[model samples]
Target: MPDTETPAPQLLELARSLGVATEYWDWQGEHVTVPEGTVRAVLEALGVDVSTPEAVRLSAVELDERPWRRVLPPSVVVRQGARTAVPVHLPHGTSVAAWIELEDGGRRELVQQERWVEPRVVDGGQVGEASFELPADLPLGWHRLRARVGDAEPAVAALVVTPDRLTLPASVAGRRAWGVMTQLYQVRSRRSWGVGDLADLAELASWTGGDLGADFVLVNPLHAAEPVAPMEPSPYLPTTRRFVNPLYIRVEAIDEVAYMPAAQRQLLEWQAEAVQATNGDDTIDRDGAWAAKRSALETVFRLPRSPGRQIAFERYCVEQGEGLVDFATWCALAEEHGPAWTQWPEQLHDPRSAAVAEERERLADTVELHRWMQWVVDEQLATAHRRAREAGMRLGVVHDLAVGVHPEGADVWGLGPALARGVTVGAPPDPFNQQGQDWSQPPWRPDQLAELGYAPYRDMLRTVLRHAGGIRIDHVIGLFRLWWVPAGQPPTEGTYVRYDHEALVGILALEAQRSGALVVGEDLGVVEPWVRTYLEERGVLGTSILWFERQEGGVPLRPEAWRELCLASVTTHDLPPSAGYLAGEHVDLRARLELLTRPVEQERALDEADRAQVLDAVRARGLLREGAGEQEVVEALHRYLTWAPSRLLGVALADMVGDHRTVNQPGTDEEYPNWRVPLADGSGTVLLLEDVVRSRRARSLARAVRTR
Candidate 1:
């Protein structure tokens, strides 16, 4: 209909050049061809113009020639001890000299390699390519390459040397460590403002690591959400992964709060009491809590900062530089123009527009307020990390990194052009989610990322790993490739867009190595086998959920069969805890939501059979006795994990207390509460953090995996 000048074969070739997979093997082992329209839409989202045959040809030629047009690549990420050649483009007959400037202020001259190739004309000037070989003895850090071509100014590009394979910390070296995992928002304490805050996390980590003799306490992502009320409930869909959510900031924990006026303190006390009253409520109230907390925080924010505090805040602002200002400016603007920048006035849509610049000056105070909020969060997070390590935890707090940021949130608004516009990141059809999923979070344009030296991606990783001893990448497979669902299209119509894993994963490991932290990738759904091996080679652990770890004929995979480089767990957040899973709660939940492709009874029967096989395996391994109760089966399942040689064993807090509810139900938005479910025990009675610490059931489960 649209001039079909871009023929099917030509379109496929162009898509292939852009790393869009035209055909891929699904989870069902069937080859599925991606729709032509899907390819066109995906390409357009990548800023490729395929409207006309001439345009398509130009795009392809540009793709091949763009590198020749540059003096040096935007960035170069290479592993230590690996000799990689950097291509330096210059005017055909011009002479050049290149050298690497190490992060430690050292310099190394790069040796020129003989590269014989015909000169090509780019932009009416003949360009020649020269190869500079990187030394194998380069140190790991953020370095730069400087190339002086002819009489022009020297060209500079980012040159990063990442670790070849990250090694485990000495604290966790040679020993299998176990940890407790939970969604922190659901584990509210009486002291919190109707939700779990950083103070509560410190308490949870202190108790679990010191008392329970655990190595670490893993929690859900603390990524920022909208400042206003009616917040997005799912932590996985956040405003920005670069900053912490102010909602999780404990007001009383702020130092300035203690220095506030007496009358203001009294009013804050009353506000805390009002919000804490909702702690026992079945559903977690994010809107009410943030609305009240943000006001209380604002009062403390207004109090004059101590001289030392002021210096620290200013230093943070200077270190964060333009990115922080842009984010804060976007936040202030959102307060007036609304959260979605796309819906703002046309002139304000571009973050760099003159109108937005003027608006930033007009909203300077609000912008500073937002920046101050982040500084507070950073201090609180650091305190939590310090407490965890002091309590004898090997890895301290391991934070979860969500897959992507919200579509209309700060990242999309602040990051301008780095993220795709017309496509969203999602999942392909898998056994767990039959119809697939559209997460409504935009994917990064691979080309743009490489062009920008991956600054945004690196900034995100550096921030998340800043206070963490370890970080789990949600949907880690996304680093290699992501399913790109076109605008207004279902996930089934999407295609796989490949990413440069060699560079992406190398940068990830590089950041973790620099931070002295471990990396765990949630490589659970529809992952290619080679991808798992590649991750392991980089010393990044894979995630293994017991239910999904199956062997031949879909039977249970023996404990010894699980990979050692994995974080093995009996249950995950998406599914019910071990207790509820044993009772077939997941099947009943799907049936109720009408998410089943088969009859409810038939689905229940199949689930029962699967459960029986796993339980039987547990019994055969002598972890459970014959005719054991639900509690024994749950504990035994975890005890079953201990038999596996996985480096890290993850015990869910819900499974420990025999909580029967699922924290999230996939494929349903309004039909289920998803991430809003509070922590509860076996009888469906909600429990506070204080209640959980002294529970006998929890202690019993803790003992199950504490030793071998």
Candidate 2:
């Protein structure tokens, strides 16, 4: 049991000042108090010392003095067309001047706004707080602000100007569109080397858009993973979100590989043949496929590059700049000292250390190889997007962005203290997941993020949207706040930590607008009511899964009553595919894995009740007839989603061929083959891309969705 003693007032105040919540309402509608220990742990993660009353008091004083001590805040984010004020603190009666340096090298004078508050004495000196108003017509880009107090050194801070709101692209404006969502790695084709690659994705997009008249093809995150075997399989827990995984690169698609010497080409062909043998297996062997692919890629990597190719590779390296170098360096170092940076030598732990710099030079060739791998994947990803456009996809490919990266992965190794330590990002106990979930990934320190001007966040968004027509942010609620679980503690013992949603969302919209991409937030579970409205106000679509759309008393909401600004779907990747869900396969699997919190019989009874309600709803909506089977119910559910006024509708590919197996079972890892199951048909037979394109059942489901 947690301590029930009242927390010290100073401790609570310090926690609040650091954005840590002392209490939050749980799913059961009970006001659960966060233990003082939990609060202190979270504060310490944020670099605050609150171990004792004196420490808490000192921390609170520092928090209060921070803004006044600095000439300006670390960074200021303002929406375009809004006259924003920047606060400046200086000695009483000191004259101040401020100016803005535009992103394009232009300068503009800012006017000092009127003072609205009285001065206060701090640290034996009176400090007056003043405001300066930025030009309302400032352009949308990153700018700089320079503030000068009379005869004092000028202080500079980052200024980010964002668009008021993101708007839909011309192709999708005022139009209802539909798309197909799939686990890209599971959708194999004859040409792929075991796992589905960019070529396979392009082929699917082309066929669906050109033949089925679909507007987009949404796929799982293609984020980078470990370079060696024993790789992390879940796409949600990637090594780096900014770079594409080389595992998804179709080796033969590279032009240089096509022009390889005959002997090398033959060896590559043999390696490809060996990998392709796994294509028919029910489980995806990522390790086996990568081992073979890596060998072939090395052969190509060693070949002399043509003058044109050499110039292009150098250009890409230059464009990527220091970020690419840091990532590539981490990759090379990981290969030498193993994947976890913490286990490596202390001298190589810090990315900026002199030893690390010398290591980069010593392992220059290995670093270049990692860089080349990224370039290969980048080119193939671009080709896939181009193919989607050529095949008449309105919005083309919609990419998924995972919530966070692995704690011991490249991003953490490179990002350093920007990511919190000791505590992991997770969720408190919720209705569906009674035990709560610890994601095991570090959360970004809000203060550190602001101090760095949110460059890391912006960079991630830019990379994800590079070749995507749209992007889905998994666990989108995290943008506003994250539940922080202390190390060695259960997720239920976590507390909410608030972030500057204004700045985060503003920057998100700005990046989406600049990229001409649509944004969709996966706000399906436990989201605040205002968050949906907030996202809609910014033209970001919310996710509405069919089974979870309910009114008061748990009755399913009518399709017409669903939110218009949403991506309506019959099922999501997290849940069982529609077919298996209707048949209660998830219940049986959970029971077998011992993942059920309640008795099996009781859980089954509840699942049956839920299924019956959904069936009745479908019948009432005229989507299903009496005694409809699982296959019919699957079609009806998708058809029902089409009736929604949502701007975007998504059809899961698993439902098309009537695959009953779940793609992922959240609570279980090795007990269930998560992220390894290949796409299959109703009979549990693995289905290749060619088989899917020609399947009559797939065509039937596509027709039902398109008929609307």
Candidate 3:
């Protein structure tokens, strides 16, 4: 156990300087102090040495002195169309020269805006601070700042210029648009091999956008998972945010498959058919589907690429550069050793070791195969986006970006030292999750991120936004702060860590602006009030769930009272679909799984009261009729959502088919089939894409929102 005794002031100051919270208020409204040992451990993971009082004092002094020592700070982010002053540190009375290099190879001179301040003693020398003014009209992109002081080496720092706000595209600005939200893997069609793929996504978009007059289709994260069997089912925990999972690829959709020899193609077709046999099963067989798909993909990879195809592939390789190589190499290594890189031989653990280089050479073929798989997925994603646009969707495909990457995954391994060690990202205990929740994904060290100019984060956003018309950032509060839970500690013992929201959010807005895409932040559950206001001020839409919109007396807030800058929905994946929620299936499932925090009877009573309030609200609006069944109530709820002033409204696909199962339960993993549940009706009948399009329930729900 960590020592809870009084901590030295210097220790607390050092921790604060490193962005670790020394104390925080818990959900119970009580002040809780972080253990001294926990703080030290977290600091160490952040690469700060605070093992003793002397070390803490020394670290504190270094923190104050380091910024002054550097000719220019490691990185600086300024909002576009705003003139900002950047500080420059130099020896006392020394003259400095500085210039800005734009992203397009253009250069501009910066003017020193302020006179030098009085010199201060630092490490036996006097240092002076002065301010330089940056032009207000600098283009939005990553730029460079070069500075020189006296006879010293030229110092260069990254200067990221970003937009002040993310604005909606003209195509979607003046209209109230409705869309469908779905877990793509669970929405398998008759043509899919057990698991839904990009091809199905395109088809669904075409049906909804073209036939139903929907404007967008929002799907769960398609981020990459481990390349091997026993794949991680949760899309929120990914191996790499920069790449898409090849498991979601359609085998027959690749152009090269058409040119393959007859025998090989027949074998692949047989495998696909056999895999498709599981489509009607209650749960998806991810491992089986992946194995069969992998075999077919292996065959497809053997077909020689045509000249034009080869040129495109090579261009992609060059564009991706070292990042792709590192990720592909990690995949190949996982194939040989296993998914957990920590359990591998010591020499192979370090990505830059000579042994890894030799191993990369030995496994060059496997690495290339992994790279080929990425290219295939990228092509399919582009096709899906194109299809949505062709079908007249405004914000065609709104992709989800998961919060963080898995601990033993590609990003952590490849971007070694950039990610903090021995800590996980999670949430504090709340009413919904009494024990709090810990997601075993490592977070990026704030210091390291700034040191590297947030390149990894930039690369990830750029990649995901490449073919997306909009993006939903899951747990978007993470941009401002994240709960850093020490390894081997309960989530209740975690502390909040602050991030540079200005830089982070500014970069996000810049990227969205450049991509001409909309940004919707999932700002639900225990978020600071200021964060939402900030996001709204920046034109980033927030997420609003119908059940949680309430006033002080627990009365459901009226539809018209809800925030206009939101994507309103009746339910989320974390809860049961509207049909099941109305039936109290969530309570029953929790009871069965031993997840109830109170007695089942009491819990059900409270749930009933909550349901009554929601129904009463709908009844008052005349949207619900007397003795309405779950289907009618579901439509009524959606109709209520349409009444809100929100620009974008979402209708879950599961609700359209009256699926009774929840896509995920917050605190439990193996206790329930979280992400594996197929889209099913109230009677537990599996519903495929074809059934969804033809179902009267789906069309009725669509009509409710469209007519509203």
Candidate 4:
């Protein structure tokens, strides 16, 4: 923990110093008086020099007590070509400001700014209403209306200004809703030797949509990772969120592959064999995988760039100019300076300095190489999405947008001031992770992001949604509140920092609306209950993990009570596969690495009981027969998960393949093998595509998808 004793005061001071609202403050109970000296002391502790009256004046703008989510409501509708009236409910003692802006550069400019809309003095829950009017002179295109109340983030929605207010698409407004969340590289593929590539994704669409009746296939983040050894295994910490990872591209699936030279085609086959051999077990080597793909792409790059490929590349470059250039520059810097740019020479390190541009020009080939790779990734992903749509899928491809980027990544380098320099994003201590977890990624500067009109965020969303029908925002609470650990502080010693949640959700809604994409928030752990309600109201889905789907206030919720606004799952990548959890493989895996906090015997004893109880409960629920075998247990669990009320469901690839280990473990990095775990059969040989498809468990899962 930091030397500073009072975190709340210091946190409030920090927010005040930054001219942002603080979510909480220290006030003597019912006093209506706060110590000015206490506030000053807090400011000093956070390293703010606030002696002057101007500083005090700024800080005096009463610290905001409400959470960001409370301030921001979800969506609203408006009529076209008329001054429309709409009444919206607000929280107790809330203040609302209403305004509208047309697509054609016209603004209504907070016309009825900051009107206090107090709730009626009722005995039950608080609720009140405020009325706002829309602009009459709006164009036929989409318009936006915004209303803000208190510390709540503003509520925003796009108004379809048309002659007729027709109902929205069935995928958006009706019952045909479901999206798949896949780890693209980890999918059980047929064509490509081992890892799932764009071709496999295309195949999955045919299988899921045609055979299993899935609406969408949501994949894990396919964003580009830093292309070097000891690569970060987690897709969330990508080198560039704006670009796709080329490692996911199938060289053999390229349209111009037939025209490749004989030597190159043979090399491709050889590389494919090597890839298969490399991932022949229940582990994946991302570095090795990327190296093999890079070698093959180099061969392809050596040949003439196809006209169609060149045109697509040009279009992408135009769409992503500065971001792409900056990302390529960061990639080049990583090559020379290593992953951490802070270790580089001062002149070459600064992202905006002319020296960096000079360095980029000097290493032009490397930069363009990164660009070419992204273009290919984009093309293949787009093709996969097209295939899913053609297969009659409701929601084509759902992509994952990680909460943050690697601190030494393109996003941080490009949006320098938009990220806090000495802070890291992490979670507070919870039951699962007692000491808490620091993700080692930088959180966006809320004020700076808002000031820049959220361009970086908007662009990142636009890029990720390019070929996605839906997106799962991992750790979605970061949009409203992020647990920020100051540099050199332990993970537990962090403050709940707030953001412009209304603007964030508004931007999300706007983008999702424009792209015709659904939004899902991974809103688990320590989240305020209302966050789910807010997300649901905005058409954003929530994640419902089986382990955490308990009734509020510590009671275990019945499976049937699971909310419809969730993507229910038996296990997540961070946790063990269902079979592994049932068999106590997690305890064994942890024990192997000396990661167990308790004594080995004690841990094993606990695991035995937990495992037995879960199995017994399942059997009692008629999911399993008494004394069922391990295979029987697996089948029963699948049936139980399918019965969940969540509209969308995810079956982890590891579970599907019966792999005991997880793709990632929270704490230990090298202490245990982390992300190298592959999808394999029980015999330990790489489960070939044919073998996986033929498995009993796979058949059962397929049946669940087709029937339920």
The regions of model 4 sitting more than 4 angstroms off are 1-4, 7-169, 172-181, 188-194, 267-276, 306-308, 552-555, 588-617
Tens-place lDDT per residue, model 4, 266-339, is 87888888876755556667777778888888777767766877897789888788888888888877887787
Superior candidate under TM-score, 2 versus 4: 2
Ranking of all predicted structures according to lDDT, beginning with the best and ending with the worst? 1, 3, 2, 4
TM-score of 3: 0.98
Per-prediction TM-score: 0.97, 0.98, 0.98, 0.80
Reference-based TM-score, model 2: 0.98
Per-residue CA lDDT of model 1 for 282-356, tens digit only, reads 999999999899889889989998899999999998878888898898889888978887798999887888998
After superposition on all CA atoms, what RMSD does each candidate show versus the true structure? 1.8, 1.3, 1.4, 8.5
What are the lDDT scores of the predictions, listed in order? 0.90, 0.89, 0.90, 0.68
lDDT score, candidate 1: 0.90
Whole-structure CA lDDT of model 2:
0.89
Q: Which is superior by lDDT, 2 or 4? A: 2
Write the residue-wise lDDT of candidate 3 on 1-708 in tens digits: 656765578888888887888998876678888888778778888877887778888888888888898889889999888888888899888888889999999998988875647778998999998788999999999999988888888789999998888889888899888999999998799889899999999999999999998899999999999999889999999999999999999999999988888898889889989999999999988999999998889888889999999999989889888899999999999999999999999999888999999999999989999999999999999999999989999989999999999999999999998889999999988766767889988988888889998899899998899998899999999999899888998777778889999999999999998999999999988798999999998889999999999998889999898999899999998999998899898888878877666888998999899999999989998999999987889999999888899999999999999888889988788999889999888899998899998988888889999977
